[model samples]
Target: MSKRCFLIEASNQEATEGQIMTVVQSSASHPLYGDIVTIVGKNRVNDNPVIISAYSKDSCHLEAERPGIVVMPNSVEEVQKIVRLCSSTKTPIMPAGGRNGICGACLPRVTNAVMLDMINMNGIVNLDEDVMTITVEAGMRWAELIHRLDDKGYKLGFRGPYGGNAATVAGSVSINSMGYAASRFGPAPEGVVSLEVVLPNGEIVRTGSGWNPEAQIFTRYSSFADLTGIFLGDHGTLGVKTKVTFKIYPKAEFSTYIDLGYKNLKDATAAFLEIQKRGLTEELNCLLARESADTYFPGLLDSHPEINATIHCVIMETDKQLAERKVQIIRDIGLDLKGKDLGNFAAQIHWAEKFNEVQPMYNNGFWLNTCHLRPISRIPELMDRMRAIFKKYSLEKNGIKWIADALAVDRAYAAAWVTIFAPTKDKMELAEKAWNEMLDAAMETGGCPYWSGLLWEKRALEKVNDTFIQLYRTIKKSIDP
Candidate 1:
């Protein structure tokens, strides 16, 4: 921990860099600190992790809150010990997983906080063949997990975001993440069966069937209440997730793409709503707005200049006939809405090149995208507000673009996201302003942003009811105390 200076006003935000430097230097004296350091090893725990090291760089856009000390525990017991140590020291502990999240959720808002890098904690706990479930430590990345499961002839219904190579399983659960195969099985919350959490006070609580020794890991329902929901999408406010359990699925029998080109946003969004109502697609995503298609996909808009919004859908079924029929249903609706069938070849290519198709690699360079979750019906207004924000910030030339992705879950729709590539320092500032405005517009349109990371805390506060906030505060105090 370096003695870097952190300036502050009288109100809000705790700890100066100088204080963090002093505190962490003296943290070794805490009662259990020595044991934890000895177990986790000082090398992995004392300094910042490499993934978030560039967090201090303004141009990096990592939004990592300044960290005092980082701890990487390899086992559940080690995590418990570390949590207990932080609890006793009255230190705020923030957990970071893969450092791939855009919402700044892993960053510590409270100054001089402890960063619990969970990568070392990853381990395969169990694979119950009969129950079709697997128990894994929190830090397992989706790529590794998927490969492991595939080798065993099994797969998950829900999965990590496009950045699955670095996205953590527990992190996905906490954020209610959406990504590939989502149209078939919903998001992170749907597949999760249980979680083992270390509360802020260092107490380890197992949700779901783990509570019953006789039927452990078999079921999530209880005679009293199912407690796993409390930890899902919690953003680490209540506790640190140590382990996760979820059901596995047989690999999909068939999967293909369906492309629809709308002349304008209105018809395109209507087609989206129709497809959403049916909920048959394995994955549903669209590149709306000509600017977005041009800037991010470069040459894409040139090829489809007449298209206002291009939807690329993934159709899945056990048999080819069934899948083709589902495709017709969507095609009919899209045409009914005055949309043109752009053919599936283009969308199929994009689906095949899903992970590396280029949002982050535009003309200027790296890009940032912000998204909000709303109903299918409200997507039109949401997209309009996003356009307004880009116009207001004079950011259209900054390569600004937007999209909408339909959630695999029933009656669920996401107003996809707005993307802008700002390769330079000055342009990045403008893009960031556009991002904030995009969030505001989501709220104004009666929609909530995707993740409740630190970035959206203030906006959430403004819209969240006081009673719910009070209850949350009370719960945080009780478990975290």
Candidate 2:
């Protein structure tokens, strides 16, 4: 069986450049006849994968390392045909969005599969200012969406962290992404007003219609069943998302970022819990010593080597003088827990410059890696337990320290993270061990890991009751079987 790849470019709703050269096939082609096709478009690939080749670099996030066959489906019908062919042939069809996933969830694991690249289907269908929602093809990048929305003084919920330099809105939502602004607007799944999916059997379906004012609340299939929810976090294992409609919010007038330090995790978390209760701040992120600080702010390590605990940060947006008061509140609360007030600043220019710098190391040739755990309230007690496990593991000796940060989802919830500095090759193993231990710890506290980290190993999978895999299987069977 010969596999082929094509570089497709769509223009005027038709396959133009590279796609025209490759022969479309239903099954594996002859070695001499097979061609490997890659689809290239603006905002279609990620920057990291681009380093390998100009083809990977130029395309947005949809890089396929051993891409068998790259087919760019320019219209809904084209996508449907591709899905149908794959389903009938039992070929593993991988849908390419922006390929920014750290866990390789978007890429097809099965060999001799077809890659249905969706970067070409990006057409703006509607922008209802009154309704405060926009419908666009699934291939539109968040950066493009942000630019389009900024013209109307609107912004979508937090762009997912997998939201690469050029990740698309559809790809982010397909994986149920959570972004930097999660504290304010929640995850990308929260912003989805509707979805247009091409099922495995080549059926076209719409999740919700913003135009329908009488749309049923949260129902996807029957009035009692939610088909959309089943596929929301399915990680593209269900079907290819062709279009998405999500809500947007007005841009904030003022935004400030304050960085603070605590004596230890206990003191910092105590303050974080209380500040969350007050509900004055817009977004707060607590980066444990290993995660946020090491990835984004490495310079701090050189200056304060002994500061091996945790750093707390917040982005508060408001025109009121409440900025200073909010700082005071955080300080006071931390003080009660015997935490030290590191410093505070209210500089708009500075904060704006640093606003989208979550993984600053990406610009400097380092892979900006991250994973989401469960929400905070359910994980704090578990985090304490994990800390004990870390102590027993003694990571510092291996030059591997677990840096973590968390955001308060509500008064009773917090989502904590752990960042490990190790070789990429060893990361999978370490993450496997850490995740299993973490999952066990979290389960003890009745918390589950985030939706994005659904690709982890058996131990972690067991913690979530194989929900991710089961969801994928159910959707695939329904759509394909």
lDDT of 2 by residue, 93-163 (tens): 77767666555556555555566667777767666555566677877777777766778677776645534
Score each candidate by Cα lDDT: 0.70, 0.56
TM-score of each: 0.86, 0.73
lDDT of 2: 0.56
Off by over 4 Å in 2: 1-67, 210-225, 290-295, 298-339, 345-370, 375-395, 423-447, 452-454, 464-476
Prediction 1 TM-score vs. true: 0.86
Tens digits of per-residue lDDT, candidate 1, 312-367, equal: 78886668898888888888888888988877876677667655554355555445
In model 1, the Cα lDDT at residue 425 comes to: 71
Model 2 residue 322 CA deviation in Å: 6.1
